[model samples]
Target: MADLVFTVFTSLDSYIEKPGGVFAPPPWSDEVGEAWSNAALARAQHLIYGRVNFEFNKGFWSAAETDPNSIAAGIDYAPKMNALPKTVMSRTLTGDPGWNGRIAGPDIAAEVARLKRDVTGGDIFAFSGAGAAETLFGADLVDEFWLMITPQLFGDGKPLFREGRPESTMRLVECRPLDVGSVILRYRRASEG
Candidate 1:
């Protein structure tokens, strides 16, 4: 069975996004970009996203296709990222996402389950922060988590785990320190769970 993984970049305080819609940019550097490209994006065969993130990524990345070296693309692997198939989970989105993407139905867990079975990709990845990740985690659908912890912290911001999700235990696969004091943590749900 294809495994569902949540790969996200978060602050030391566990915030995914800044509070109040203010952009709290991660400490992104060339080294960090290359590391992400080589480590996560390169291995991914397919990607899944929450509705808002899907739309945002499509617009942002699609426009930078012609200029792979542009700041917006931010990596040498733009083409690969653009080509990967994506499924966007949305209840309100009715049509195609213009890019090589699909709109998943309202039942997020069931749809993800179907994808896990049917996807020929080596692994299915979701970078949905807390929105879809919470739902998937709650349903026990996520098999692994790949979190890149930035060195900085935001005292109050959008958290990676929300208020009411059930607790889950994970087994650490490895923790690697990257450039500029960032760390990438790989963990899988305990087998006995």
Candidate 2:
């Protein structure tokens, strides 16, 4: 079975986005981007997202794949990202999701659980989908977490985890610091360790 990995880029204080709904810019040096791309390519076989993030990523990365002027175009990231299969978890979103994507059925947890059972050997990544992450985390379906934390802190913003979440233990698997002062932390469910 595949591991369901909840991955996010956050500020030092664990905010996934700044106060104005804007994301904190990723600390991307060429070396950092390369390493990130390599790791992404090595592990992820499927991608999951919330409606908002799904649309944003589709627009951004689709353009980045062909637009030489795009910041991410120079890196190997864009094409790989665009090529992956994506599932968008949204009840309100109708019709085609575009960009090699599909709308997940009403039951978020069930869909993810099905993916976990079917997709063998690789990881199913929940990328920047706060709601989806929370749902999967709550369902006890999340097997790993990959958090990339930038050096700066957002005093207040959207947090990765909210109040009243179930308690669970994690074992640190890797901690790598980037040249840009960002750190990538990987954790697996403690039972798996």
Candidate 3:
């Protein structure tokens, strides 16, 4: 079975985005970018937002397949995110055959759980900010969280946690600081009460 992982780029002040829905492009230094690039590829199975994030990532990653110096080339996530079984949670999207995606209307929980049972190995990862992250978290379906904390602080903006966390908790399993002030933190969901 595959593990459910949610990863995001968050500022030190606990904001995923600045006011007006603006986001900092991830720092892609040779070392840091390479690390993040490989980290994403390891997830293997990608569960993503249907429209905005999908279009954005699809453009960059699909291009990385050819661009040598691009971070996409180093990680090899393009083909992985494209080829691996994926479920895009969206009511507004009509999954195009070109992207090899399916339109999942309602029954979001049922669909996610089904995908979990379907995958033999690897992992299912949710990308982007509060909206999609909150949905999966509220459903209590996420098994692990890989948060990349950037050094900058947005003061007040987008946040990761909202209401309806199921009264559960997580135990910090790992923490590593990169060359830059940004850090990588990993947590595993604690057993449910």
Candidate 4:
């Protein structure tokens, strides 16, 4: 079974992007990127995302494929993710003809649960989809969360997490600091209603 994890780069103000909903500059360092990529490749078998992030990354990473080493390992892994299977949690998107996966419905907990038992032993990652994140959180399907927090802040910015009735309680499992003043925090989902 593959675990369901998430990769999000948030600002100190708890925003994942700027006022325009565009993600902030690439704040990942080689070490940070490598660690994330290694962790990604180690446990995640699929890339799940929102339409916005999916499109933005589709263009950003496609242009950097030639020089894999020139980009962060996460970006370097783009091609792999491009070629890998993905599942987007979108309602407005109508087309993804060349995409590696499909858009799923709201009731994804069943599908996610089934994916968890596929015997691949990788992770099913939610790649910056606040809506999907919220949905999964509401469903109590996520096992762990991997949050990459940067030092900067945007007083008015896109939300870093899906807002809902917060889980009864989430337990912190670990925290790692990066050289670029960013920190990665991991949390395990505790008992929920």
**What are the Cα lDDT values of the candidates?**
0.79, 0.83, 0.71, 0.72
Candidate 3 on 1-193: residue-level lDDT in tens?
7777788878888888888888676565666765665776665565656456766767766666667787767664456765655566665766472455666558768877777788665777777567777778778878888888888878887786777778767888778788887788888877622
Off by over 4 Å in 2: 64-72
For model 4 the TM-score comes to: 0.82
Model 2 collision count: 0
Steric clashes per prediction:
0, 0, 0, 3
- Clashing pairs for model 4 are 43-122, 43-123, 44-123
Among these predictions, the greatest lDDT belongs to 2
Q: Which digits, one per residue and each the tens of the lDDT, describe model 1 over residues 2-44? A: 7887888888999888887454556766777776656777567
Select the stronger candidate by TM-score from 2 and 4: 2
lDDT of 4 by residue, 1-193 (tens): 6778877778888887788766586476788867666677666678777777777666666555555554533454666766667777777876663467677766788778877887385678888556666777778777778888889978887686655645556788779888889888988666521
Error of 3 at 44 (Å): 2.0
lDDT of 4 at 26: 44
User: How many angstroms is residue 171 displaced in model 3 relative to the true structure, after the best TM-score fit?
Assistant: 1.4
TM-score of 3: 0.85
Each prediction's TM-score versus the true structure: 0.89, 0.91, 0.85, 0.82
Q: Lowest summed lDDT over 10 consecutive residues: which window, candidate 4? A: 67-76
In model 2, the clashing pairs are: none
